[model samples]
Target: MQRIAVLTSGGDSPGMNAAIRAVVRKAIYHGLEVIGIKRGYSGFIEADMWPMDLSSVGDIIHRGGTILRTARSEEFKTSEGRKKAYLNVQRFGIQGLVVVGGDGSFRGAEIFNSEYNLPVIGVPGTIDNDITGTEYTIGFETATNTVLDAINKIRDTATSHERTFILEVMGRESGCIALMAGLAGGAESILIPELRYSIDEVCEKLIRGYKRGKLHSIIIVAEGAGRGLDIGKQISEKTGLETKVTILGHLQRGGSPTAFDRNLASRMGSKAVEALMEGYRKHMVGIVADKIVISPLDAAFKGKRTIDLEIYNLANILSI
Candidate 1:
């Protein structure tokens, strides 16, 4: 029987558990012994592992975060650490490994596969949605939904107080989450890392809204777009308008997987299994145009995928 190991790394996001559950079930159904690695690259070096079965993954599809948990370990970067990890894999008799994480995880997978000849499969699990090979990652949809919920609530408070609230969502380098959530939440202005805006322009917009007798305004800013608090201060100083700022932190990564995420995870997980069975190794399972596909792990690690400019422009047009 084939032995496989799986782990999640980097920042946690919604639907990670669902992906893990799918990996376990799909691998086991294919007559492979599945092992769950605790923590992340650290667990691999420390040899922290546990047996995973259907029962162990029961009811996790609806959960958030990860059942096996996650962390960042610099050990994976060191040659010694890589060697130790290779020894551990052999010790456990693991043949194929699955990693669910963002770009950092993909980098580690590429190095591990290149140096040790270990076949590693990557599943995009970051809220940033910055991984190039995948059109949409597992946690991105749920994170968008979570931000929308918060944006709605903030809108209510802003309207009541007649205040202009600047809401900040997390998406370190990639603006995918901010773009989608801002568009869906009907934000008046969206600031994304991919697009830079003039502070004077934003103030002018606020001034225009005030002239139009708009009581409240919602401006969504990506964390990496700039600085939410700084922007709010600037707006308050420029427009002499009362402003409130809300930063949605890990809250975006802690909700139950949405219907879309559950379905996507199941499909991606199953496809990953099929790819392995077909003798395709060292790849990432990604969804492009609603179809399951595999891309080279190295390619995913090399390219920088940011928010699509056309989509961002369309969002601006539609918002107008």
Candidate 2:
């Protein structure tokens, strides 16, 4: 491929800038021209793109979010919109494409490629970490760390008041963040959508911890599982314990990416460029067992990334 374009779509996630930087610099290093598409497929449809160079991505490795920006394009769902995007692709003489985002973004790229015959590679970049092909998405570690830090601070207050704190973390269809943060933060209870949870059982666990002379209890709830405020009210009514709810909305989506995230983004980003260079189309670069693996982009959306039941059980077992 002589020239390629890259874009980030869907929700903004930490470490996306790192991924973008990697894609730009790696492409330039390989003597290939790079184009930055602003606002994802919307930009592609509108032809809102510009050439990128090494300096174009300077000092963005530690930054959060994408320099190229992202958006959900309702217009892009239409055949007319894809036709417009294809026109731009032809206009720019773009030979390959790199897409960084979650499942929805991958699905769009997959469709766009099939219709236009453009070589496309995907790099997973969602905080939800729900993409099936990857073991961990770009921003998952940073978001989990963000939640863990909040839990640590909340623990101090919960202990001081001897109260139950219900922390709601972002995870609409997945519980990776809540489960990981809850387990690492030593939460007394974790409620996730993937696993059916009973408020009564949650209350029982809290009451048992209190009877055992525990000064405080931390309960982590994925938003998909339940609303923190409702869960808190129910726990207070059932257990007669003072409860506080902290909804960490959007907070988990912003931050300087953690080292693990930066490294993962860099590796995945470079792999995406390499994939295109190797003439792989409609594929995604993912990490498994700390090694980079490429899979068909369809694989990312065809299945679901299930929560680790072993980790869930371990968290429950250790909470006691």
Candidate 3:
């Protein structure tokens, strides 16, 4: 392929800039021209793109969020919109494409490739880590660390006031963040959507901990499982204990990416360009067992990524 274009879609995630930098430098190293698509598929439809060089992505290896930016394009879901995108692809003489984002982004790439027969490679980049096939998505480790830090800080105050603190972390459809952070933070209880949990059970755990002379309690709740305010109120009513709620929200999505994330993004980003150049279309670059692996793009988003029940059980046992 003589030319390739790259874009970041879906929600912004840390280490995305690192991925972008890798794609540009790697493509240039291969003597191929690189185009940066702004605002994702919306940019494609509007032909909002520019040629990228080495300096175009300089000093962004540790930055969070995407340099190309991203946005949801309702129009891109329709055939007419995709046709417009394809027209731009032809206009630019693009030979292949690299998509950096999460499950939804991969799905879009898969469909676009099917219709246009364009070569496309995907690089997973979401904090949710909900994408299948890949053991871990790009921003997961950094986000988990962010949550762990917040939990540590919150625990200090919870102990000082001898109160219960319910922390709500990001995870609208997955519990990976809550489960990981809760386990690492030594939370007394963790409520996740994957496993049904009752307020009574949570309160009982808190009461048991207190009976054993525990001064404070920390509970991690995935936003998908329940709201912190609602769960906190229920626990307070049932246990007659002081309760406080802290929602980490988008705070988990920002900050300089951790070393693990930067390395992962760089590896995956370079692999994506290599995949396209190797004539592998509709495929995703993932890291498994500390090695880079490639899988069909559809495989990354075809099924749900399940929580590690073994780890969940261990967390429960250790917390008790």
Candidate 4:
């Protein structure tokens, strides 16, 4: 492959800039021309591309979000849109393509590889950490740390006012953020979409805690389990505790990438370019047991990554 292009798709995650930097530098190190495709598949269709060199990526490894930017392209889902993108790939002489995103982006990459036979590699870059084949995704560490920070601060007030605080973390279909953050934050209860959680059971726990003279508590709720407001309301009504809701919203997605995230992004990015050099395509990069590995690009589309039941069970036990 003489020239390769890379793009970030779907929601941007922390350490994406590091991945971009590594992709650009690694490809240049291997004597390959690198092109930065803005806004993912949309950029591919519209030819929103520019040559990237070492200078183009210098000093961005510590940054959050993607410097190349990202967007969820609706048009890219259609056959016609894909045809347009293939035309751009041909015109730009891009022999291999690197896509950095979650499962949705990999689905596109898989189809593109099948339909056009373009060499493609995927890098998991979601905070959800819900993609299969890898234990941790790019932004999960940073986002979890962000949630921990919020919980730590909220704990101060909860302790002072003898209140119960409900923190809502972002996770539509997965509970990874809530599970990890809840455990790390020492939350009393962690509610996630993956498991059945009854509000009555939660109220009983709170009631028991109160009877035990536990005056303050923290609950981490994944958005998918229930809205923070509704959860707070139900808990307050049932337990008669002063419950407050705090929605972290998009705050978890911002800020500088953590060292773990930066390192992971760098490793994954370089490995992606190396995979292309080794004639691997329609594949995704992953880290398992701290070692870089490769998997089918569309592995995530088969099913969302299953939560580690052991970890979840341990969290439940520790909470008790």
How accurate locally, in lDDT, is each candidate? 0.87, 0.94, 0.94, 0.92
- Name the runs in model 1 displaced over 4 angstroms: none
Q: What is the lDDT of residue 109 in candidate 2?
A: 92
Better of 1 and 4 by TM-score: 4
Q: Please, what are the lDDT tens digits per residue for candidate 1 over residues 244-297? A: 999988899888989988888888877776777777779999999999889998
Taking every candidate in turn, the Cα RMSD to the unseen true structure, in Å, is 1.2, 0.7, 0.8, 0.9
- By descending lDDT, how would the candidates be arranged? 2, 3, 4, 1
C-alpha RMSD of candidate 2 = 0.7
* Consecutive 10-residue window with the lowest summed lDDT within model 4: 298-307
Candidate 3: worst-modelled 10 consecutive residues by lDDT: 296-305
TM-score of each: 0.97, 0.99, 0.99, 0.98
Model 2 per-residue lDDT tens digits across residues 117-186 = 8999999999999988789999999999999999999999999999999999997879999999999999
For 1-320, candidate 4 gives per-residue lDDT tens digits of: 78999999989899999999999999999899999999888988999999999899988988888889899888999999999999998899999999999999999999999999999999999998989988889999999999999999999999899999999999678999999998888899999999998899888888888888987889999998889999999999988899999999999998899999999999999999999999998899999999999998878778677777898888878877
Off by over 4 Å in 4: none
Q: Relative to the unseen true structure, what is the C-alpha lDDT of residue 194 in candidate 2, on a scale of 0 to 100?
A: 95
lDDT (Cα) of model 4: 0.92
Evaluate residue 34 in candidate 1 and report its C-alpha lDDT on the 0 to 100 scale. Answer: 92
